[model samples]
Target chain A: MITRFLSEVRTSFNPFSPLSKTARTFLAQLPPDARATGMLIKHTILPRTSTQKPLLFVKFKDGKELKLDLETMRSTEVMAEVDRHSRILARKEELSG
Target chain B: MPPRIRLQTRQLKVRIYHHQIPSQPCFYASLATATTPAPPIEQTIHSVSPIARFPPTQPPSHKPPEVRKSQLHREYQSLLKSSPLVLIFQHNNLRAVEWMGIRRELAIALRKVDAELAATGHKDLYADAIKIQIIQTGIFASALRVVEFYNPESTELPTQHPSNPATATLAHGLSRQAHEAASDRKKKLDLAPLLSGPVAVVSFPAVSPQHLKAALSILSPSAPNFPAPKRKANPSYHEPAVQNGIQKLMMLGARVDGKAFDQEGTKWVGGISGGLDGLRGQLVGMLQNVGAGVTNALEGASQSVYFTMEGRKYMMEEAEKGPEEKKGGEEAKPEGEEAKPE
Candidate 1:
């Protein structure tokens, strides 16, 4: 099953894809450790199929990619989790500064 | 020694010379110390004084009484040039010296003295002493007037008497004209904004730190919100009175200064100097913008050197050719000239 997933990701992956612009910028801002290891599996619209939500691929340094359900990502739970993480990050930065 | 009574306020210093003789007795009070050595009294001039609500506690007096007297006399001498000795007295009763009542009566007498001085070509007498006498003969009370005091100690004598027919008429005429002019001017004007006063004259005697705090607390705009800090003497804990006083003073200053104590705009409606936080924020924001602009400019410095040079040359050419040339150019375009947009 893991082999099949890897094959599927390798086939669909496009580094120069239109959606990659925003994703790349966001990844650039991440800490060096997070950029190298962490995966942000998001379901967003591609340039070719802007009308429909597609399974978008972003490659971190790590070989294993976390598979995210497109429907689940849009849920209120994910938004709340993101907001909480952002607040924590901001507090950490404030303390460190 | 001679039943001398000294009354000192922030500005006025009253030294009652209550002599046995009512006619010859002199009542002297220093009007104002308006010169150097001791500063001018802020409370006397401005309604809105920038004095600290709770001033620092004065240290205990250690100097000898004689030293203090001489020091006071020296201070008075410094003020004497600007504010001369005012003689205020009451007839029939030499012993009774009503300081407050005498002050009121003397104020009226000074106006008359000023009129007389203006009449006698003594406009240059900036700090001349005005002698004021109050006589209560019977039930009938006459209009208050100023008279020249006959002091045997001083060489200067009154050249013109207030009772003199010619001088009295002139003084009366001058005073009437002055009142009429003042009334006319007052009718034309409505209200004037009182500016913030100078640093208050922190003098000793009568006006203490506690008195100042109380007065300021009563008059201060922030007195309602902060309310004066209550002193709780906890016997168990060694509460330093000096520290407590300093802390209270700091709090009062912060409250009066407005932005130091509270970030919330609930307390004071900004002082004459304005809110410090807002000012700091503005300064920070301005500096940040300037820094960002400089950074951006430095980054793009290599991109447009040629265009900047060309622009400078174009500006010089435009400046050299006067408005006439521009008008001529606008009126009729030459074949070589490029079409210019309005």
Candidate 2:
């Protein structure tokens, strides 16, 4: 299961691309339970101005919307953890299949 | 005396007495006449002489003028002393707004990422999406800090989570916890003297500066620190509007006072330090604790994930790979040399 998870994560698009090394390090720390619910989505209808950066609008399984920046550990770590969990789910699905 | 003697001898004596009357009447009368007006007359005539005129009025004393206290000066001094520290916290509203804007952007980013992952038919993407959403919620909560301090009487602002009920509920819970924490801190510290009349404590959302300003304006409409709310209309017309506006305002900022509910649309932003240096210190400490708690919670949440996953594995792999790679290169070098020699 761990090998499968690792393989899936390795092939997955790098979550670190948009994040800084520090942010990536922080993202690498999130717990799996933090991924179950409380997802947020930040939305920007238009491209950001030079002064501004875009935000993510997330919706959780419980129907919560949240806006977040990609730069911070708060967002990145959670993203990383979610990525791991989804891979585990995929591995389970593959086994089932 | 010669004239009295002549009176007895009528006409003959009257002529004799008239000649005798020219004589001085008394020596004492002559002496009295000499001394009477001499000194004042001499002094009046010779006025230029130093001793002649009445003693000169003593030169006006050169005592220094009394100094007076100025209220403006005192206020200026206080401002100078506290400006550096206060300035950072003064922008709390602005910081909150910036955070909210960031959160909004993040939410959009996560959604895009999530969509991309979903399109790829990758189950692994779901976790990333969920994680992004959670962070977005935290940012949103930070942004809503301004509305927490709105005045319900003057302006009707929406709550933080009007659009998203689930996040709003969580924000509300967090707000309650913050309030309880503040109250606990208040209890621990002596604030009785700092509280005046009916204690009104305003809590502005620290999510964004604009929200905090809006909240502060509700407390003091013309707070120099905050920009005025642009919209004139009450923000809380509908239930969702009220809920979201209030939550937004509460999440953004709040005013805490017994009279907060009494004011029509005004939400209370916490208390202004009642010029009591000690209470201000305590409140500052409390605010620091709150800020620290938030940061610590975020750190703990992030760190928990860091230890669990590839982070640990990555470190171990790096440690193991270092020596093996070096040894492999060295062994391969000898084999290459032997092949060349043969």
Candidate 3:
């Protein structure tokens, strides 16, 4: 399931897409254990032209892209934190029954 | 000879009594006196006397209390100058709807900052920013009108007062104008489609600073729906005209009866003419949309069902009547009534 999710992410991943640089950086920073199965989701973009932040698109295992604002360090940090939490949980479960 | 001896003895006795002769010194004292021959009594007295009588010295001088107090005062002034006080301006003239949008955007931005701080364990810094007073400016007229939109917390100076009541009123009126202009811009954004998503339209009257702050505070994505303003006794004069105009325009497109849009359209027009004094037209527009959306959704569903049920009932009634007509025709034939051949 993990391999299949990775393959899907690889297929739809556009390195040069018009996402925020911060979002791209966050995606690149995803650790080996961070990958999860999901659908590809597009980010929701605000209409304001002055907004310089890049929106983030996340693909869930179900193939849906969740739109989020990833331009801010705070938002990106949250995502990273959540990933870390999930990794910890997975490790703990593996160690248990 | 006898007489001379007697007189001399008498004179001697008288002299001895009159002189008050000191008692004979003790033998030991007499011996010591003779031996020392006098270390002079003056020398002994001088050796026994202690040193005395130096002129008194002056006390050490110190700074005056007034000088010290003045120095402290100067230091305090300098500290005050360097550490500026922040004041937040809450402008009241903005419609609540617009204020809500601005508030949400600000909350999102602040939350983003807060989250970053949390990640880096800089929560203390985030907490400090949250405590800062957010000053909102009231509606101002004149050249200073643009300053109303500035972040009150970021402003360094106080706003200048109007010279007279007339000018003050003008400034207030100008702010209202600016608010209307802002609403006009939002009006162009097709909000109906956006409503289905996470985005919401928050508005405020540009005049009230407190209302603006409330709007900003709750504009976050995580924040719950913004509260509607309390109903006021006097209807806003501008609300009715704008609502009527919009209603007329909407009527031109399609005719709707007994639907949410119709109800909203009526209420909006009525709200403008007779409800909520000082209400912003843009707010009325928002309320109308909200009310209409809910009404339309329910009414549309019910109408769809009603039409389907009515059509089925009509069809069934026709089907039942068909057998009766056939029976009547058969009865007429059996009775042998003269059938007129046409």
Q: For model 3, what is the alpha-carbon lDDT of residue B146?
A: 27
Which CAPRI quality tier does the interface of model 2 achieve? incorrect
C-alpha RMSD of each candidate structure in angstroms: 36.6, 33.2, 32.8
Q: How do the residues B252-271 of candidate 2 rate in per-residue lDDT, one tens digit apiece?
A: 11123221121211222223
Give me the displacement of residue B52 in model 1, in angstroms: 50
- Of 1 and 2, which scores higher on DockQ? 2
Give the range where candidate 2 chain B is weakest over 10 consecutive residues by summed lDDT.
B84-93
Residue B150's lDDT in candidate 3:
23
- Give the true-contact fraction for every prediction, in order: 0.00, 0.00, 0.00
Q: Return the top candidate by TM-score.
A: 3
Q: Give the chain B TM-score achieved by candidate 1.
A: 0.18
Report model 2's chain A TM-score: 0.29
Docking class of 1: incorrect
For candidate 3, the chain B TM-score comes to: 0.20
Shift of residue B92 alpha carbon in model 2, Å: 55
- Taking the tens digit of each residue's C-alpha lDDT, what string does model 1 give over B198-305? 111111122122222322232221444423334452231122322222111111111111111221221233221222334567788999999999988986785577
Q: All candidates' lDDT scores?
A: 0.30, 0.33, 0.34
RMSD of 2: 33.2
Sorted by TM-score, highest first, which candidate order results? 3, 1, 2
Q: Kindly report, for each predicted structure in the order presented, the TM-score of its chain A compared with the true chain A.
A: 0.30, 0.29, 0.36
Per-candidate interface DockQ score:
0.01, 0.01, 0.01
